[model samples]
Target: MILTFCNQKGGVGKSTTLYHLARAAVASGRRVLVVDADPQGNTTEALTVDVPSDAAGVADALSDASTDTLRDVLVEGVWDGLTVAPTVGEALNAVRDEIANSHRPGWESRLRRQLEGLKDEYDLVLIDSGPALDTLSTNAFTASDGVLIVTQSTKWSLDGLALLLRTVDEVRRYYNPTLEVAGIVLNQHEALTSGGKHYAGELEAAASENSLRLLTPYIPKRAPIKDAVDFSRGLDEGDYKARPLGKLYSALLEQIMEGTGR
Candidate 1:
């Protein structure tokens, strides 16, 4: 199964969620490949600590000048069963701009083309896209079997979800007809706060209106989740406080797998 975790809004925990999800999948004994398509490289940095600055990555695979394939850029991840195709530096920004400016037909399908034949090598491929609906994100949507929308319980986040859904529809109509939105993931949710409660209600209404499933046991706002990522440790291998949060991610992964029939 291939899934992309994305949102048009930054700081919505897309990278963080994808990181933990990869870790949880690894713990479940599944071979996981994490494709760090985001130019910011947060997922790359977190999953492959101390990756060489000059390493070939997703940017190289997408560039017209390079002969690199996605398979050629694979790097070992922090965990045993996790592999990564990293976005190491500013190269991805250049590639994104190149794709945007080029008149080449099928520019949006470059990543999809690069990802061909990878399904047999890994049980799951999870892509972490940048916080935009640009060519990079379109490529991600084009390549993915499903997209897992990540958002926080906030007014602005809810507003961005509408635009994201529209983009999904456009991609489905044009690129990958089998593409589906696996579900919505509510991250960094502060359940006890009034603002959280208000937006949570709004998010639920929006999901219902769109016939989208909101994955249960929304991730709560917690220091340990961030700490685990920051420290380059899997939630299950971090401080004891982080183990419970790891279980939540495990449950969320199960929900995603069941929803997508993986």
Candidate 2:
């Protein structure tokens, strides 16, 4: 299962979702691969166990198309079951040159094709996308079997979702027909303030009104989320268990696996 956590909008917790799921999946005795397609490298920084240069990272992987090749230098996880294809800061800029001269319509499909050759070695593959609707994300959609979109419950976010869903539909029709929008996750949910409950309620009402069937599981802001990130502890670690965000992520993971069979 290649699940891409995506949203063109930044600060919607794409990297957080990817890392949590990947970390949890590994703890559950699954061989997981993480493809960090973002230029920010937040996922890489959070998960890095070793230092690998950008020149020797993605460019080489795309150039060789070899599954067995040692592409990403940072390799971690229990028994080496978690593999990471983290983007170096250098690869992001260089890819522009490569993509410009490339001839394919969806030049982004390179990552997809690469993962196709490597799918059997792992039980799940998670991709963290950048904050744009560029060719990279198009390629991510092409390579992925499903997408898990994270968004806060807000009017502007609700509006932006229409465009995202349209893009997902187009990608399905043209590139990967089996690609599914497995779930829409509500992040930063809290019922403390009237405004909070109102906004979340409005979102839930809109989803039902539109027959969207958005996932019931949700995530909330918690101190440990920041603490975990700052301390470099993956969600599978016990450091996060006492926080609300930890339980929320655990429920979200269960909901995703049940909904998408991840």
Query: Against the true structure, whose lDDT is highest?
Result: 1
Model 1: runs farther than 4 Å from truth? none
Residue-level lDDT tens digits of model 2 in 1-262: 8888888888877787777767667766788888877878788777775555633554456542334333443366322468877677666645645665777675767777677667888898888888777777887889998988877766556667778878889999998899988788887666686766777888787667755657766677665665676566754464535444565666767777887765
Per-candidate clashes come to 0, 0
Error of 2 at 237 (Å): 3.2
Residue-by-residue lDDT tens digits, candidate 1, 1-262: 9999999999999999998999999999999999999999999988986789999999999999899999999999998999999998799999999999997999999998888878678999999999989999999999999999999999989888888999999999999999999999999999999999999999999999999999988999999999998988888897678899999999999999998888
Clashes of 1: 0
Q: What is the C-alpha RMSD of each candidate to the true structure, in Å?
A: 0.8, 3.0
Candidates' TM-scores? 0.98, 0.86
